[model samples]
Target: MAEDGRERLGIVAGGGGLPMIVANAAIEKGMEPVFARFSDGMTNDSIIGRSRAFAWGRTGDAIEWLKAEGVQKLVFCGTISSRPDFRSILPSFKTLKRLPRALRIVKGGDDRLLRNLSRYLESEGFDLLPVQAVAPELLAPEGVLTARTPTAEESAALDLAHRAATALGVLDAGQAVIASNERIIAMEGIEGTRAMMRRVAEYRAARKIGRGERLALVKAVKPGQDRRFDLPSIGVQTIDEAEAAGITAIGVSAGESLILGFDDVIDRANTAGLAVCGLGGEQGTAR
Candidate 1:
Protein backbone atom coordinates (compact mmCIF):
# COMPACT_ATOMS: atom_id res chain seq x y z
CA MET A 1 0.00 0.00 0.00
CA ALA A 2 2.98 2.24 0.42
CA GLU A 3 4.41 4.19 -2.48
CA ASP A 4 7.32 5.37 -0.33
CA GLY A 5 8.79 5.11 3.18
CA ARG A 6 5.84 7.06 4.68
CA GLU A 7 3.94 3.84 5.31
CA ARG A 8 3.21 3.93 9.03
CA LEU A 9 -0.16 2.26 9.59
CA GLY A 10 -2.80 3.69 11.89
CA ILE A 11 -5.33 1.58 13.76
CA VAL A 12 -8.55 3.63 13.61
CA ALA A 13 -9.67 2.37 17.00
CA GLY A 14 -13.21 1.97 18.29
CA GLY A 15 -13.70 -0.20 21.35
CA GLY A 16 -12.67 -3.77 22.21
CA GLY A 17 -9.51 -5.87 22.47
CA LEU A 18 -9.31 -5.96 18.67
CA PRO A 19 -7.46 -2.67 18.38
CA MET A 20 -4.94 -3.91 20.94
CA ILE A 21 -4.51 -7.23 19.14
CA VAL A 22 -3.97 -5.50 15.83
CA ALA A 23 -1.70 -2.91 17.37
CA ASN A 24 0.51 -5.64 18.90
CA ALA A 25 0.65 -7.54 15.61
CA ALA A 26 1.60 -4.39 13.72
CA ILE A 27 4.26 -3.58 16.31
CA GLU A 28 5.61 -7.15 16.22
CA LYS A 29 6.03 -6.85 12.48
CA GLY A 30 7.91 -3.59 12.99
CA MET A 31 5.17 -1.41 11.60
CA GLU A 32 4.51 1.86 13.40
CA PRO A 33 0.97 1.88 14.80
CA VAL A 34 -0.82 5.08 15.62
CA PHE A 35 -3.98 4.58 17.58
CA ALA A 36 -6.70 6.99 16.38
CA ARG A 37 -9.39 6.32 18.93
CA PHE A 38 -13.06 7.13 18.22
CA SER A 39 -14.93 8.82 21.03
CA ASP A 40 -18.16 6.97 20.23
CA GLY A 41 -16.48 3.59 20.38
CA MET A 42 -14.89 1.61 23.19
CA THR A 43 -11.37 2.43 24.33
CA ASN A 44 -9.25 0.70 26.92
CA ASP A 45 -7.28 2.44 29.65
CA SER A 46 -4.15 0.98 28.08
CA ILE A 47 -4.54 3.29 25.07
CA ILE A 48 -3.25 6.48 26.70
CA GLY A 49 0.37 5.93 25.71
CA ARG A 50 -0.09 5.48 21.96
CA SER A 51 -3.54 6.79 21.09
CA ARG A 52 -4.95 10.10 19.94
CA ALA A 53 -8.65 10.10 20.71
CA PHE A 54 -11.00 11.71 18.19
CA ALA A 55 -14.71 12.04 17.55
CA TRP A 56 -16.46 10.05 14.83
CA GLY A 57 -17.93 13.26 13.46
CA ARG A 58 -14.49 14.84 13.22
CA THR A 59 -13.50 12.90 10.12
CA GLY A 60 -11.58 15.78 8.68
CA ASP A 61 -9.68 16.27 11.91
CA ALA A 62 -8.73 12.58 12.02
CA ILE A 63 -7.62 12.52 8.41
CA GLU A 64 -5.66 15.72 8.71
CA TRP A 65 -3.97 14.43 11.86
CA LEU A 66 -3.10 11.12 10.21
CA LYS A 67 -1.62 12.90 7.25
CA ALA A 68 0.40 15.12 9.56
CA GLU A 69 1.59 12.05 11.50
CA GLY A 70 2.78 10.44 8.24
CA VAL A 71 0.26 7.64 8.37
CA GLN A 72 -0.21 6.38 4.81
CA LYS A 73 -2.26 3.35 5.73
CA LEU A 74 -5.07 2.63 8.19
CA VAL A 75 -6.95 -0.42 9.43
CA PHE A 76 -10.33 0.39 10.95
CA CYS A 77 -11.10 -1.92 13.88
CA GLY A 78 -13.51 -2.37 16.83
CA THR A 79 -17.12 -1.23 17.32
CA ILE A 80 -19.02 1.99 17.76
CA SER A 81 -22.21 1.77 19.83
CA SER A 82 -24.04 3.30 16.86
CA ARG A 83 -24.01 6.42 14.75
CA PRO A 84 -22.13 9.45 15.93
CA ASP A 85 -23.88 12.46 17.41
CA PHE A 86 -23.35 14.75 14.45
CA ARG A 87 -24.60 17.71 16.44
CA SER A 88 -21.57 17.52 18.71
CA ILE A 89 -18.64 17.53 16.27
CA LEU A 90 -17.35 20.98 15.44
CA PRO A 91 -16.32 20.60 11.84
CA SER A 92 -12.74 21.31 10.98
CA PHE A 93 -11.98 23.30 7.83
CA LYS A 94 -11.09 20.06 6.10
CA THR A 95 -14.34 18.46 7.25
CA LEU A 96 -16.28 21.49 6.05
CA LYS A 97 -14.56 21.10 2.69
CA ARG A 98 -16.07 17.64 2.35
CA LEU A 99 -19.30 18.55 4.16
CA PRO A 100 -21.59 17.51 1.34
CA ARG A 101 -20.15 14.02 1.01
CA ALA A 102 -19.89 13.67 4.76
CA LEU A 103 -23.53 14.62 5.19
CA ARG A 104 -24.54 12.05 2.59
CA ILE A 105 -22.48 9.47 4.44
CA VAL A 106 -24.15 10.33 7.73
CA LYS A 107 -27.50 9.75 6.08
CA GLY A 108 -26.58 6.28 4.82
CA GLY A 109 -26.50 2.94 6.64
CA ASP A 110 -23.52 2.00 8.80
CA ASP A 111 -21.91 -0.32 6.26
CA ARG A 112 -22.44 2.11 3.44
CA LEU A 113 -21.02 4.95 5.50
CA LEU A 114 -17.90 2.94 6.44
CA ARG A 115 -17.34 1.88 2.85
CA ASN A 116 -17.68 5.49 1.79
CA LEU A 117 -15.18 6.50 4.43
CA SER A 118 -12.69 3.92 3.18
CA ARG A 119 -13.13 5.23 -0.33
CA TYR A 120 -12.85 8.79 0.84
CA LEU A 121 -9.61 8.07 2.74
CA GLU A 122 -8.16 6.13 -0.20
CA SER A 123 -9.10 8.92 -2.54
CA GLU A 124 -7.15 11.21 -0.22
CA GLY A 125 -4.04 9.00 -0.74
CA PHE A 126 -4.28 6.80 2.35
CA ASP A 127 -4.53 3.05 1.98
CA LEU A 128 -7.32 1.14 3.73
CA LEU A 129 -6.19 -2.23 5.06
CA PRO A 130 -8.55 -5.07 5.89
CA VAL A 131 -8.46 -6.46 9.44
CA GLN A 132 -7.24 -9.83 8.11
CA ALA A 133 -4.00 -8.29 6.88
CA VAL A 134 -3.14 -7.04 10.36
CA ALA A 135 -4.31 -10.06 12.36
CA PRO A 136 -4.73 -13.22 10.30
CA GLU A 137 -4.38 -15.22 13.51
CA LEU A 138 -7.78 -13.93 14.61
CA LEU A 139 -9.61 -15.31 11.58
CA ALA A 140 -11.91 -18.19 12.37
CA PRO A 141 -11.02 -21.52 10.80
CA GLU A 142 -13.28 -24.11 9.21
CA GLY A 143 -14.86 -27.03 11.09
CA VAL A 144 -15.29 -27.41 14.82
CA LEU A 145 -13.25 -25.05 17.01
CA THR A 146 -14.31 -26.47 20.36
CA ALA A 147 -13.97 -30.07 21.62
CA ARG A 148 -17.71 -30.57 21.56
CA THR A 149 -19.42 -31.08 18.20
CA PRO A 150 -22.99 -30.09 17.46
CA THR A 151 -25.56 -32.74 18.30
CA ALA A 152 -27.73 -33.83 15.37
CA GLU A 153 -30.60 -31.66 16.48
CA GLU A 154 -28.34 -28.74 17.19
CA SER A 155 -26.74 -29.15 13.78
CA ALA A 156 -30.15 -28.73 12.24
CA ALA A 157 -30.69 -25.78 14.51
CA LEU A 158 -27.33 -24.44 13.37
CA ASP A 159 -28.36 -24.58 9.73
CA LEU A 160 -31.57 -22.77 10.52
CA ALA A 161 -29.81 -20.14 12.53
CA HIS A 162 -27.21 -19.69 9.81
CA ARG A 163 -29.86 -19.04 7.20
CA ALA A 164 -31.65 -16.65 9.47
CA ALA A 165 -28.49 -14.76 10.27
CA THR A 166 -27.60 -14.62 6.58
CA ALA A 167 -30.95 -13.03 5.73
CA LEU A 168 -30.62 -10.61 8.61
CA GLY A 169 -27.09 -9.75 7.55
CA VAL A 170 -28.15 -9.13 3.98
CA LEU A 171 -30.35 -6.39 5.33
CA ASP A 172 -27.49 -5.11 7.52
CA ALA A 173 -29.74 -5.85 10.47
CA GLY A 174 -27.20 -7.53 12.77
CA GLN A 175 -24.59 -10.29 12.99
CA ALA A 176 -25.92 -12.87 15.44
CA VAL A 177 -29.03 -14.73 16.51
CA ILE A 178 -30.15 -17.14 19.21
CA ALA A 179 -32.44 -19.84 17.82
CA SER A 180 -34.29 -22.64 19.52
CA ASN A 181 -35.92 -25.72 17.97
CA GLU A 182 -35.93 -23.94 14.56
CA ARG A 183 -37.48 -20.77 15.92
CA ILE A 184 -35.53 -17.54 16.12
CA ILE A 185 -35.61 -16.40 19.73
CA ALA A 186 -33.28 -13.46 19.59
CA MET A 187 -31.39 -11.33 17.10
CA GLU A 188 -28.54 -8.97 17.79
CA GLY A 189 -29.91 -5.46 17.50
CA ILE A 190 -28.46 -2.25 18.87
CA GLU A 191 -28.25 -4.24 22.12
CA GLY A 192 -25.50 -6.45 20.58
CA THR A 193 -24.75 -10.16 20.89
CA ARG A 194 -24.13 -10.51 24.60
CA ALA A 195 -27.20 -8.55 25.57
CA MET A 196 -29.23 -10.53 23.08
CA MET A 197 -28.02 -13.72 24.70
CA ARG A 198 -28.96 -12.44 28.14
CA ARG A 199 -32.40 -11.58 26.80
CA VAL A 200 -32.67 -15.13 25.53
CA ALA A 201 -31.88 -16.38 29.03
CA GLU A 202 -34.73 -14.32 30.40
CA TYR A 203 -37.06 -15.68 27.75
CA ARG A 204 -36.09 -19.29 28.44
CA ALA A 205 -36.76 -18.80 32.13
CA ALA A 206 -40.12 -17.17 31.48
CA ARG A 207 -41.13 -19.58 28.72
CA LYS A 208 -39.97 -22.62 30.69
CA ILE A 209 -37.54 -23.67 27.94
CA GLY A 210 -35.16 -25.88 29.94
CA ARG A 211 -31.45 -25.82 29.17
CA GLY A 212 -30.21 -28.41 26.69
CA GLU A 213 -29.00 -28.78 23.09
CA ARG A 214 -32.23 -27.26 21.88
CA LEU A 215 -30.75 -23.89 21.05
CA ALA A 216 -27.90 -22.65 18.87
CA LEU A 217 -26.48 -19.24 18.15
CA VAL A 218 -25.14 -18.36 14.73
CA LYS A 219 -23.09 -15.43 13.40
CA ALA A 220 -22.80 -14.62 9.73
CA VAL A 221 -21.11 -12.02 7.63
CA LYS A 222 -23.42 -9.73 5.72
CA PRO A 223 -23.75 -10.31 2.02
CA GLY A 224 -20.91 -8.24 0.57
CA GLN A 225 -19.98 -7.12 4.07
CA ASP A 226 -17.40 -4.35 4.21
CA ARG A 227 -14.16 -5.65 5.69
CA ARG A 228 -13.03 -2.37 7.16
CA PHE A 229 -15.24 -2.32 10.26
CA ASP A 230 -17.68 -4.30 12.38
CA LEU A 231 -16.41 -7.77 11.51
CA PRO A 232 -18.16 -10.48 13.46
CA SER A 233 -16.10 -11.50 16.46
CA ILE A 234 -16.44 -14.09 19.19
CA GLY A 235 -14.49 -14.54 22.41
CA VAL A 236 -14.57 -16.17 25.83
CA GLN A 237 -17.35 -13.76 26.71
CA THR A 238 -19.37 -15.14 23.81
CA ILE A 239 -19.05 -18.63 25.21
CA ASP A 240 -20.12 -17.48 28.65
CA GLU A 241 -23.12 -15.65 27.23
CA ALA A 242 -24.18 -18.63 25.16
CA GLU A 243 -23.99 -20.90 28.15
CA ALA A 244 -26.08 -18.49 30.13
CA ALA A 245 -28.67 -18.39 27.33
CA GLY A 246 -29.26 -22.12 27.25
CA ILE A 247 -27.43 -22.21 23.95
CA THR A 248 -25.48 -25.41 23.45
CA ALA A 249 -23.90 -24.63 20.09
CA ILE A 250 -22.52 -21.71 18.09
CA GLY A 251 -21.77 -21.31 14.41
CA VAL A 252 -19.94 -18.66 12.43
CA SER A 253 -19.05 -18.36 8.81
CA ALA A 254 -15.47 -19.54 8.45
CA GLY A 255 -12.96 -16.82 7.54
CA GLU A 256 -15.72 -14.21 7.82
CA SER A 257 -15.67 -13.99 11.63
CA LEU A 258 -12.83 -13.51 14.07
CA ILE A 259 -12.14 -15.48 17.24
CA LEU A 260 -10.39 -13.16 19.66
CA GLY A 261 -8.11 -15.03 22.03
CA PHE A 262 -8.82 -17.90 19.66
CA ASP A 263 -7.49 -20.62 21.93
CA ASP A 264 -9.22 -19.22 24.98
CA VAL A 265 -12.53 -19.00 23.12
CA ILE A 266 -12.35 -22.66 22.13
CA ASP A 267 -11.18 -23.74 25.56
CA ARG A 268 -13.99 -21.86 27.23
CA ALA A 269 -16.54 -23.38 24.86
CA ASN A 270 -15.21 -26.84 25.60
CA THR A 271 -15.30 -26.22 29.33
CA ALA A 272 -18.83 -24.93 29.08
CA GLY A 273 -19.86 -28.02 27.14
CA LEU A 274 -20.83 -25.92 24.16
CA ALA A 275 -20.14 -26.73 20.54
CA VAL A 276 -18.44 -23.97 18.51
CA CYS A 277 -18.10 -24.62 14.79
CA GLY A 278 -16.99 -22.48 11.92
CA LEU A 279 -19.15 -23.25 8.96
CA GLY A 280 -19.02 -22.59 5.20
CA GLY A 281 -16.32 -23.32 2.65
CA GLU A 282 -16.41 -22.78 -1.05
CA GLN A 283 -14.07 -24.33 -3.61
CA GLY A 284 -11.96 -25.81 -0.78
CA THR A 285 -11.23 -22.47 0.83
CA ALA A 286 -12.53 -21.04 4.07
CA ARG A 287 -15.18 -18.41 3.30
Candidate 2:
Protein backbone atom coordinates (compact mmCIF):
# COMPACT_ATOMS: atom_id res chain seq x y z
CA MET A 1 0.00 0.00 0.00
CA ALA A 2 1.13 3.54 -0.83
CA GLU A 3 1.37 6.40 1.69
CA ASP A 4 -1.17 8.32 -0.40
CA GLY A 5 -3.82 5.75 0.53
CA ARG A 6 -3.98 4.48 -3.05
CA GLU A 7 -3.77 0.74 -3.51
CA ARG A 8 -0.59 -0.71 -5.01
CA LEU A 9 -0.30 -0.37 -8.77
CA GLY A 10 -0.84 -3.60 -10.69
CA ILE A 11 0.72 -4.07 -14.14
CA VAL A 12 -0.24 -6.56 -16.84
CA ALA A 13 2.93 -7.06 -18.83
CA GLY A 14 2.67 -8.64 -22.25
CA GLY A 15 6.12 -8.59 -23.88
CA GLY A 16 9.29 -6.53 -24.48
CA GLY A 17 11.02 -3.97 -22.24
CA LEU A 18 7.99 -1.75 -21.95
CA PRO A 19 6.51 -3.65 -19.00
CA MET A 20 9.73 -3.55 -17.01
CA ILE A 21 10.01 0.16 -17.68
CA VAL A 22 6.49 0.73 -16.41
CA ALA A 23 7.11 -1.28 -13.25
CA ASN A 24 10.30 0.63 -12.52
CA ALA A 25 8.59 3.93 -13.14
CA ALA A 26 5.79 3.10 -10.75
CA ILE A 27 8.27 2.20 -7.99
CA GLU A 28 10.15 5.45 -8.56
CA LYS A 29 6.87 7.26 -8.09
CA GLY A 30 6.40 5.69 -4.66
CA MET A 31 3.79 3.12 -5.64
CA GLU A 32 3.94 -0.60 -4.95
CA PRO A 33 4.11 -2.43 -8.28
CA VAL A 34 2.64 -5.84 -9.04
CA PHE A 35 2.89 -7.50 -12.44
CA ALA A 36 0.92 -10.19 -14.22
CA ARG A 37 3.11 -11.10 -17.17
CA PHE A 38 2.81 -13.49 -20.09
CA SER A 39 5.27 -16.38 -19.71
CA ASP A 40 7.30 -16.30 -22.95
CA GLY A 41 6.81 -12.70 -23.96
CA MET A 42 8.52 -10.49 -21.36
CA THR A 43 12.05 -9.49 -22.39
CA ASN A 44 13.63 -9.72 -18.94
CA ASP A 45 12.80 -12.13 -16.15
CA SER A 46 14.73 -9.83 -13.81
CA ILE A 47 11.67 -7.60 -13.80
CA ILE A 48 10.03 -10.15 -11.49
CA GLY A 49 12.63 -9.28 -8.87
CA ARG A 50 11.60 -5.65 -9.00
CA SER A 51 7.94 -6.41 -8.32
CA ARG A 52 5.46 -9.16 -7.61
CA ALA A 53 4.91 -11.10 -10.84
CA PHE A 54 2.89 -14.10 -12.04
CA ALA A 55 2.60 -15.89 -15.34
CA TRP A 56 -0.16 -15.31 -17.92
CA GLY A 57 -2.16 -18.51 -17.61
CA ARG A 58 -3.19 -17.35 -14.16
CA THR A 59 -4.36 -13.83 -15.10
CA GLY A 60 -7.67 -14.24 -13.31
CA ASP A 61 -5.77 -15.69 -10.38
CA ALA A 62 -3.26 -12.85 -10.63
CA ILE A 63 -6.03 -10.31 -10.38
CA GLU A 64 -7.03 -11.87 -7.10
CA TRP A 65 -3.40 -11.79 -6.03
CA LEU A 66 -3.22 -8.06 -6.73
CA LYS A 67 -6.33 -7.47 -4.72
CA ALA A 68 -4.73 -9.37 -1.85
CA GLU A 69 -1.66 -7.14 -2.27
CA GLY A 70 -3.93 -4.09 -1.97
CA VAL A 71 -3.52 -3.02 -5.59
CA GLN A 72 -6.37 -0.83 -6.81
CA LYS A 73 -4.85 0.75 -9.91
CA LEU A 74 -3.63 -1.26 -12.93
CA VAL A 75 -1.63 -0.52 -16.06
CA PHE A 76 -0.98 -2.81 -19.04
CA CYS A 77 2.15 -2.59 -21.17
CA GLY A 78 4.07 -4.34 -23.99
CA THR A 79 3.04 -6.06 -27.17
CA ILE A 80 1.24 -9.40 -27.24
CA SER A 81 2.05 -10.54 -30.75
CA SER A 82 -1.36 -11.01 -32.32
CA ARG A 83 -2.19 -14.66 -32.81
CA PRO A 84 -4.74 -16.45 -34.96
CA ASP A 85 -4.88 -19.40 -32.62
CA PHE A 86 -7.48 -18.71 -29.97
CA ARG A 87 -6.67 -21.82 -27.98
CA SER A 88 -3.91 -20.07 -26.06
CA ILE A 89 -6.28 -17.73 -24.26
CA LEU A 90 -7.71 -19.97 -21.55
CA PRO A 91 -10.24 -17.58 -20.09
CA SER A 92 -11.76 -18.48 -16.72
CA PHE A 93 -15.51 -19.03 -16.39
CA LYS A 94 -15.86 -15.41 -15.28
CA THR A 95 -14.14 -14.18 -18.43
CA LEU A 96 -15.65 -16.95 -20.55
CA LYS A 97 -19.17 -15.81 -19.78
CA ARG A 98 -18.32 -12.44 -21.24
CA LEU A 99 -16.42 -13.85 -24.25
CA PRO A 100 -19.15 -13.00 -26.71
CA ARG A 101 -19.22 -9.35 -25.71
CA ALA A 102 -15.42 -9.19 -25.60
CA LEU A 103 -15.19 -10.65 -29.08
CA ARG A 104 -17.80 -8.23 -30.34
CA ILE A 105 -15.79 -5.34 -28.92
CA VAL A 106 -12.28 -6.49 -29.93
CA LYS A 107 -12.87 -7.36 -33.58
CA GLY A 108 -9.30 -8.67 -34.00
CA GLY A 109 -6.85 -5.84 -33.14
CA ASP A 110 -4.56 -4.92 -30.27
CA ASP A 111 -6.34 -1.64 -29.51
CA ARG A 112 -9.77 -3.23 -29.37
CA LEU A 113 -8.65 -6.10 -27.14
CA LEU A 114 -6.98 -3.68 -24.72
CA ARG A 115 -10.09 -1.52 -24.57
CA ASN A 116 -12.17 -4.56 -23.75
CA LEU A 117 -9.66 -5.74 -21.17
CA SER A 118 -9.60 -2.31 -19.53
CA ARG A 119 -13.39 -2.32 -19.27
CA TYR A 120 -13.34 -5.81 -17.77
CA LEU A 121 -10.73 -4.88 -15.15
CA GLU A 122 -12.58 -1.71 -14.20
CA SER A 123 -15.74 -3.70 -13.71
CA GLU A 124 -13.75 -5.97 -11.37
CA GLY A 125 -12.99 -2.95 -9.13
CA PHE A 126 -9.47 -2.21 -10.34
CA ASP A 127 -9.04 1.26 -11.79
CA LEU A 128 -7.08 0.99 -15.03
CA LEU A 129 -4.51 3.75 -15.53
CA PRO A 130 -3.03 4.82 -18.86
CA VAL A 131 0.32 3.18 -19.54
CA GLN A 132 1.78 6.59 -20.43
CA ALA A 133 0.90 7.94 -17.01
CA VAL A 134 3.59 5.72 -15.52
CA ALA A 135 6.47 6.88 -17.73
CA PRO A 136 5.73 9.92 -19.84
CA GLU A 137 9.46 10.25 -20.60
CA LEU A 138 9.15 7.35 -23.03
CA LEU A 139 7.29 9.67 -25.36
CA ALA A 140 9.40 10.82 -28.29
CA PRO A 141 10.63 14.41 -28.38
CA GLU A 142 9.77 16.80 -31.18
CA GLY A 143 12.28 17.50 -34.03
CA VAL A 144 14.90 15.45 -35.84
CA LEU A 145 16.63 12.53 -34.11
CA THR A 146 19.46 11.90 -36.54
CA ALA A 147 22.64 13.56 -37.79
CA ARG A 148 21.81 13.12 -41.44
CA THR A 149 19.05 15.24 -42.94
CA PRO A 150 16.55 14.06 -45.53
CA THR A 151 17.20 14.77 -49.18
CA ALA A 152 14.67 16.68 -51.26
CA GLU A 153 13.52 13.48 -52.97
CA GLU A 154 13.28 11.69 -49.64
CA SER A 155 11.23 14.56 -48.25
CA ALA A 156 8.66 14.17 -51.01
CA ALA A 157 8.41 10.46 -50.37
CA LEU A 158 8.01 11.05 -46.64
CA ASP A 159 5.16 13.49 -47.15
CA LEU A 160 3.29 11.01 -49.32
CA ALA A 161 3.88 8.13 -46.92
CA HIS A 162 2.87 10.19 -43.89
CA ARG A 163 -0.49 11.03 -45.37
CA ALA A 164 -1.06 7.42 -46.35
CA ALA A 165 -0.16 6.14 -42.90
CA THR A 166 -2.31 8.76 -41.17
CA ALA A 167 -5.27 7.80 -43.37
CA LEU A 168 -4.79 4.11 -42.62
CA GLY A 169 -4.58 4.90 -38.92
CA VAL A 170 -7.90 6.71 -39.11
CA LEU A 171 -9.39 3.55 -40.58
CA ASP A 172 -8.19 1.45 -37.59
CA ALA A 173 -5.49 -0.10 -39.74
CA GLY A 174 -1.91 -0.44 -38.54
CA GLN A 175 0.42 2.53 -37.89
CA ALA A 176 3.39 2.10 -40.25
CA VAL A 177 3.70 2.82 -43.96
CA ILE A 178 6.80 2.28 -46.12
CA ALA A 179 7.32 4.18 -49.35
CA SER A 180 10.16 4.57 -51.83
CA ASN A 181 10.61 6.65 -54.99
CA GLU A 182 7.02 7.87 -54.64
CA ARG A 183 5.55 4.35 -54.58
CA ILE A 184 4.07 2.73 -51.50
CA ILE A 185 6.15 -0.29 -50.60
CA ALA A 186 3.90 -1.58 -47.86
CA MET A 187 1.14 -0.57 -45.47
CA GLU A 188 1.26 -2.06 -41.99
CA GLY A 189 -1.50 -4.56 -41.32
CA ILE A 190 -1.91 -6.96 -38.40
CA GLU A 191 1.64 -8.25 -39.10
CA GLY A 192 3.02 -5.04 -37.48
CA THR A 193 5.70 -2.51 -38.44
CA ARG A 194 8.69 -4.82 -38.13
CA ALA A 195 7.07 -7.46 -40.32
CA MET A 196 6.13 -4.81 -42.85
CA MET A 197 9.72 -3.49 -42.88
CA ARG A 198 11.11 -6.98 -43.46
CA ARG A 199 8.73 -7.49 -46.37
CA VAL A 200 9.86 -4.20 -47.92
CA ALA A 201 13.50 -5.14 -47.44
CA GLU A 202 12.94 -8.47 -49.14
CA TYR A 203 11.31 -6.79 -52.09
CA ARG A 204 14.02 -4.14 -52.38
CA ALA A 205 16.81 -6.71 -52.00
CA ALA A 206 15.35 -8.82 -54.76
CA ARG A 207 15.32 -5.88 -57.14
CA LYS A 208 18.83 -4.43 -56.82
CA ILE A 209 22.07 -4.82 -54.91
CA GLY A 210 23.01 -1.29 -53.78
CA ARG A 211 20.90 1.43 -55.31
CA GLY A 212 21.52 3.59 -52.18
CA GLU A 213 17.99 4.98 -52.39
CA ARG A 214 16.28 3.96 -49.13
CA LEU A 215 12.67 3.49 -48.17
CA ALA A 216 10.94 5.89 -45.76
CA LEU A 217 9.03 4.51 -42.74
CA VAL A 218 6.29 6.61 -41.18
CA LYS A 219 4.24 5.77 -38.07
CA ALA A 220 1.53 7.83 -36.39
CA VAL A 221 -1.41 7.48 -34.05
CA LYS A 222 -4.93 7.36 -35.40
CA PRO A 223 -6.66 10.74 -35.79
CA GLY A 224 -9.14 10.10 -32.96
CA GLN A 225 -7.72 7.42 -30.67
CA ASP A 226 -7.88 7.08 -26.91
CA ARG A 227 -4.35 7.84 -25.70
CA ARG A 228 -4.24 5.28 -22.89
CA PHE A 229 -3.77 2.06 -24.89
CA ASP A 230 -2.09 1.16 -28.15
CA LEU A 231 -0.05 4.36 -28.31
CA PRO A 232 2.53 4.17 -31.12
CA SER A 233 5.92 2.96 -29.94
CA ILE A 234 9.41 2.71 -31.41
CA GLY A 235 12.66 1.57 -29.85
CA VAL A 236 16.23 0.48 -30.49
CA GLN A 237 14.87 -2.60 -32.22
CA THR A 238 12.81 -0.41 -34.52
CA ILE A 239 15.86 1.63 -35.53
CA ASP A 240 17.90 -1.55 -36.04
CA GLU A 241 15.26 -2.97 -38.33
CA ALA A 242 15.06 0.22 -40.38
CA GLU A 243 18.82 0.48 -40.68
CA ALA A 244 19.14 -3.18 -41.65
CA ALA A 245 16.51 -2.69 -44.30
CA GLY A 246 18.42 0.37 -45.67
CA ILE A 247 15.64 2.75 -44.71
CA THR A 248 16.84 6.37 -44.93
CA ALA A 249 14.29 8.06 -42.69
CA ILE A 250 11.66 7.33 -40.06
CA GLY A 251 8.82 9.63 -39.00
CA VAL A 252 6.73 9.29 -35.86
CA SER A 253 4.22 11.52 -34.13
CA ALA A 254 6.06 13.67 -31.60
CA GLY A 255 3.85 13.32 -28.53
CA GLU A 256 1.98 10.20 -29.60
CA SER A 257 4.82 7.73 -30.22
CA LEU A 258 6.75 6.36 -27.29
CA ILE A 259 10.46 5.98 -28.06
CA LEU A 260 11.65 3.11 -25.92
CA GLY A 261 15.43 3.14 -25.30
CA PHE A 262 15.58 6.65 -26.67
CA ASP A 263 19.30 7.34 -26.46
CA ASP A 264 20.38 4.03 -27.98
CA VAL A 265 17.90 4.43 -30.79
CA ILE A 266 19.23 7.90 -31.65
CA ASP A 267 22.84 6.69 -31.51
CA ARG A 268 22.02 3.79 -33.83
CA ALA A 269 20.14 6.04 -36.25
CA ASN A 270 23.03 8.52 -36.38
CA THR A 271 25.59 5.78 -36.92
CA ALA A 272 23.53 4.27 -39.71
CA GLY A 273 22.98 7.64 -41.40
CA LEU A 274 19.24 7.23 -40.91
CA ALA A 275 17.07 10.27 -40.34
CA VAL A 276 14.57 10.00 -37.46
CA CYS A 277 12.14 12.84 -36.85
CA GLY A 278 9.08 13.54 -34.74
CA LEU A 279 6.15 15.02 -36.62
CA GLY A 280 4.68 18.07 -34.91
CA GLY A 281 1.11 19.34 -35.15
CA GLU A 282 1.09 19.72 -38.95
CA GLN A 283 2.09 16.76 -41.07
CA GLY A 284 5.16 17.94 -42.93
CA THR A 285 8.61 16.73 -43.88
CA ALA A 286 11.40 16.92 -41.29
CA ARG A 287 15.04 16.81 -42.29
Cα lDDT of model 1 by residue, 1-287, tens digit:
23444347888887778888888888777777888987654776566434687776677888888888888888988777767666777777777788888878766666777878877888889888888898888888888777777777788888878878878878878888777655777787677887888888888888757555399888878887886677899888888988888888888889878999988888888889989888883322111
- Per-residue lDDT of candidate 2, residues 1-287 (tens digit): 85566447878776678887887788788777777666554545767643545433344566677777788888877776744234566667644665566555556455666676677778889887787788988887888877877777777778778888888977878888988756787898888888888887787779742476658888888776667777788888998898777788888888888998888989988888888888775856665
The 0-to-1 C-alpha lDDT of every candidate, in the order given, reads: 0.79, 0.75
Instruction: Show the lowest summed lDDT stretch of 10 residues, model 1.
Output: 278-287
Model 2 weakest lDDT span, ten residues long: 49-58
Candidate 2 overall Cα lDDT vs. reference? 0.75
Q: Residue 137, candidate 1: how far off, in angstroms?
A: 1.1
Badly placed stretches (over 4 Å) of model 1 are 1-7, 208-213, 281-287
Q: On a 0 to 100 scale, what is the lDDT of residue 189 in model 2?
A: 87
Q: What is the lDDT, from 0 to 100, of the residue 142 in candidate 2?
A: 80
Tell me each candidate's TM-score: 0.91, 0.87
Summed backbone clashes in each candidate are 1, 0
